[model samples]
Target chain A: MSTIFAHGGQLAHGVLLTMLMTVLGFGCALVAGVVLAVFHISPVPPLHRLAVGYVAVFRNIPLLVWLVLFVFGLPEIGLLYPLFGTVTAAMALYWAAFICEAVRSGIRTVPPGQIEAARALGFGFSQLLRHLVLPQAVRSMVQPLGTVFIALTLNTSLAAAVGVRELTGETQFFTITYDIPIPAFAVTTAIYVLITLAGGLLTGRLERKLAFKR
Target chain B: MNTGASTLFDLPGPAGRRRIRIATVVSLLLIVVAVVAVVRRLTTHGMLAADEWRVFTQWPTIRFLLGGVWATVLVTVVAMAIALPAGALVALVRLSRARVARALGRAYVEVFRAIPLLLLLYMFLFGLPRLGLTFPVFWQLTLAIVLNNAAVFAEILRAGILAVERGQSEAASSLGMTYWQAMWLVVIPQAVRKVVPALVGQSVRLLKDSSLGYVVSYLELLHQSQVLGEYYHTVLPTYLVAAVVYIAINITLSRFAHLLENRGLRGVRRRRHPESTALAENAAIGSGGRAPLIDDSTV
Candidate 1:
């Protein structure tokens, strides 16, 4: 793995870029997810239909196609965005459907009794959600959200298709071009494993911490 | 609707309805504007021109992509052929009473599950040849998909096994059956029924994930599309065609999974008596949780 040392700083930067993409993608997903979840649970039939339609189309299409569309088709349509930005945006849009589902599931887990208690106490819609429903929903959301984020990390590799030098792309460049396939892939895979395992461990701990209230 | 007390929101009054109508109008307008803008841009780029559209009639390119489709189907079948048995074995070992086997299985599942399938493909393709072990491009892609998907499938099976009630084995033991007999006959059958939808879902993902076979120069559907695009200078339509093709495959797979799930549900419903309706309800809840597919394609 000395080749790892040889490209030490570059590999570290690649890891950082991958992490950044994941965080950005996840951040976008959270915003879109909340909005979509709101639309899904909205009383307005049209809003609900819109949310359902969005999730249906986005969820079924592959992210690679999204990447292709954004990278090539967008510019043809005169939409200008950086390569990295476009890819992360595509990932966010794709993954937000998943996050929306998780949030919807969490909202469902809020017991009828709790909702009733909040209503009887004269809690308004936002107040009831904030104080009673959402707090409880948080406990149920940790595991699924964690899974989605980990998968998002894996998906950052898709950026390579559009020439973004994230971890997988960097590893590939070193392997195929630099002829250090074994060492580069080993190092890169190790980092991915470590990051994912650590994320899993954190989520497990979070689940346990939330276990009591549930 | 107004009679029920609510948590998220109360029923909208006339004012609220007006506001919702406005919001709905605005959202619909936004969608229309976006579509119109994209369509205008496409026209400006001559994407709808007869010359640009000519790629569709290019017999050579169509044949190439069709060949790629053939390669894709072949890879998925062969890979799953290997992965299914491997995953089953790993899941069984993980479910075993032996601590060592369980630990090994856990490690295998977690490690591989954490690693991206694309990285795994690269590892096998570029990494293997260095150790004086070369494989045909087809076998290389197949091995990569098999190895990674096996790990994912193992976890899916393990979870399914755990979801099953413990009393199944206990009843088997009382009937003088060994652990293996209980697992193979009683526990596994139930678990398999519960997990069938998930397994089929993962197969759809496998079909999509195999698109990464492009990177290794395997002439899969995506790669052939890329080649066609470069040749025809019609990147947009070429990739759009590829996307449509991929979508078609994915939709078909999910439909098959949906069909399998319904048939399985019918079987479960037919077998369960009124007293065991609780069991049927539990199956419904458990199966609603989608099976974890290997990659991001599990929708």
Candidate 2:
């Protein structure tokens, strides 16, 4: 207990880094997911094929492999960066594939007639997407999106392998430094549980509020 | 629905006109660049360069990775085997009239689903050893996978059960069947058909997630690949091979799921139409001031 309290500042820093990675990864996932989803549902055959391949490649490979590739491989070919950017970009790219699939399904749940009606009302493609399709899809996608967010949060722990001082990495560092593995990881696990529960509650509340109008 | 009437000229206005043009141009440009890049890479690094291809011919590493693949398959199959029956039981408990069972089942699902698989892996792998109750690494990894998947499978099974129409149960009961018999014979078969696709998808996810066993020093495919990369100093090729293997397995599983979904849809279509028509007619009669005549007593 004394040792853990002694390392409280390190634990706090670890928790903060974990939250930063989660938020950054998830934000990138949302933007990339939307783009990929649109590409997938586009009418062009080649675009659809490209989107399908992207999802397949990312989803099938383990996240660890992708992180290693970006962290180690990219620099070999001359694209070098800070460890944080490399890991974050890789995590975002990997999870974005899943997010794309979820978002595409949400888009499919929207009635086709809604888009048709927008078209009939002289709405441009952009206008129709912004005004009609996206709002409805966003509302319907809350649960799956939340699931992806939680998954991403857990997965960011993989960044520890690349030397990112996230929660898992920090705990490992403290364990080795202080010769106390159990308490260090226990506290780390508790912090993770707390963050995930808070995220779940916030998303659940948002889902309910969004549904009230319906 | 005059499909032919809406030609390009018939589209409403100039609102979409410029946007469509810009989208087309940008997409074409992206496609060209992508094609060029692929062609350049393939030509520069031929399909079978000695440096890239030599890793597979290394007997020891290949053997290790193959062994790891078998472990992955075994873990996935065993976990799914355990989870399916357990999930069905939990689903039944959730749907049962017993209040305590329902609460217990719901709590199981929520707790397991809320916890991350990695944390559960850590608990079983490291935490239990501290309590002086240790499992072999394989069993530890398998337990973690099974527990995580069982929670997801329970949800899938519950949704499947809920999809079974109420009339089917009533019909089975009218024929003097017990609740369990009706559930087993009439309801579960239909429910399984509805959820088989989702079950396969989850199984694929389980297979992928098993790679996380690397964290616990389990010698799965991902771990083996990492070992090879560390040995040869060629991380990219080893991982490329691993990624290809995973893609192959996922595609195969997805294809099987597609086949099952098609078969289930056909079966449902064969049975649903007549029953739906009859129910519609009966509903009309009841709304027109006639009793359902089958009676509340029969239920």
Candidate 3:
């Protein structure tokens, strides 16, 4: 049991991996989400349909299933990979669908008058999107995006199934090795609670700041 | 932002058309590439072995999956049953005149809401034994779901309750109802109606999140799928089936909610609007008013 904490370095390594996955996956999801939201709200009929379908499928399917499909199912045809990359890619893809919808909702909340104003000011499509639409949309998006980030952080725990030594995986390893499930898991839960609370606090402050700006 | 319908198609002529065409082609090409990559991978690896496919058809896996479905349903129903009442209580507590009760209610909500559902399940399953409390797998899972979901539902219900007109509560009190009676009989009824859509939405979420039980080795659908995958080494098919089952169930539930929402609105109109009620009653009286009376009373 003493050996578990004695090897605190291993736990730190796991925490590092967890943070890396959260940042990378969420970063990718944000970019993909913005792009998809643009397409979804665009005047192009085909793009709109495609974006809708993408959201429907990904949003409906379980994230674990997506992870399995990428890790186990994808390699069958020859797209082999290191497990880490596969799991990360899968997480990014799955969350991208959700984030896209959030961004779209945010974008929709921007009044049409704002867009019209931008147009009347002689703004082109790109300019209007960059200057007027995106800034307001992003403001409205702060709260939802914060929730998504927390979700992404929590969901990264699922990557443990694919053998990524994230915090959960490390806790599992210590539990099995020490044969003391309670203490190991207690520590894990505490860590999770701490991180989530910090996130909530930070996001709450940001939300207030954004509201004040408006 | 009413940009008007004409703005949708008012692109800047030939160059704009050409650019749009190029953009469409590029997006399509990207999707095609991704699809081809996925298809190529799926076909080559032969995800399910022949024997594994046979095993999936076997009675035990079938029974297990079906049993998992039942467990999932039971857990959801029981959890929501508990959560609804518990959530209402918590909401009432939060809205109570007493500061201590409100603080306690608010604390419970914040703590539970911030904690991930999966971690809560783990705590219930593994943590309780140390404190000399034990529950069977089903109860443990159900309790975890209820606790986590109640926190969320409490918030939702409180929002709904707050959305109700302050006059409604005052009116109930003015009519000689006690605070509790006013809450339960008047405030809650209206609040529930307003929150029906969101309640259904959360129920769908609960159904999906129940899959998290797999982590604690609860034999829900995902757990059943994992077992089959371990046995037959057909990880993908088993999960695919589970995913499809979940999606099908949720879609059906959502459609039902939509139907109920439409019916409920109609019901509200017929009951609340005296003019509509009179018209409906008159139309019914011409054809025997019993049916409309029954409908109106039900609403």
For each candidate in turn, give its C-alpha RMSD to the true structure in angstroms.
3.4, 8.1, 7.6
* B75-148 per-residue lDDT for model 2 (tens digits): 78888899888888888998999999999998777667655676676667555676687888888988888887
Residues B1-299, candidate 1, lDDT per residue (tens digit)? 21121346656788888988888888778878888987888898788889987868878767888998899889989999999989989999988889999999888887887788888877777788889998888988888888888987887777778878899889999999998899998888777666676687678778877788777888898888878887878887888888888877776777766676667767766877654445645554543434333222121
Candidate 1 regions with alpha-carbon error over 4 angstroms: A111-123, B1-11, B57-64, B275-278, B285-299
Ranking by lDDT: 1, 2, 3
Q: What is the interface RMSD of each candidate, in Å?
A: 4.7, 10.4, 8.7
Using DockQ, rank the candidates from best to worst: 1, 2, 3
lDDT string, candidate 1, A1-214, tens digits: 6767878888888899999999999999999988998888877666788787777666666677778778876776568788899899999998998788777767777777778877788888788878888788888888878888888888789888678988988888888767888878778878988988888788889988888652
Write the residue-wise lDDT of candidate 3 on B164-221 in tens digits: 7899899999999999899989988877765666577678767877777676678888
lDDT of 1 at A62: 68
Q: Judged by DockQ, which candidate is best?
A: 1
Q: Write the per-residue lDDT of candidate 3 for residues A96-169, one digit (tens) a residue.
A: 87788677656756777777777877888778777776777777777777777877887788787667888887
Tell me the deviation in Å of residue A166 in model 1.
2.2
* Winner on DockQ (1 vs 3): 1
Query: Where is model 3 more than 4 Å wrong at Cα?
Result: A1-11, A113-123, A179-186, A212-214, B1-26, B47-64, B273-299
TM-score of 1: 0.90
Model 2 C-alpha lDDT per residue in residues A108-160, reported as the tens digit of each score: 55666666777788877677778877787878678778878887887788787
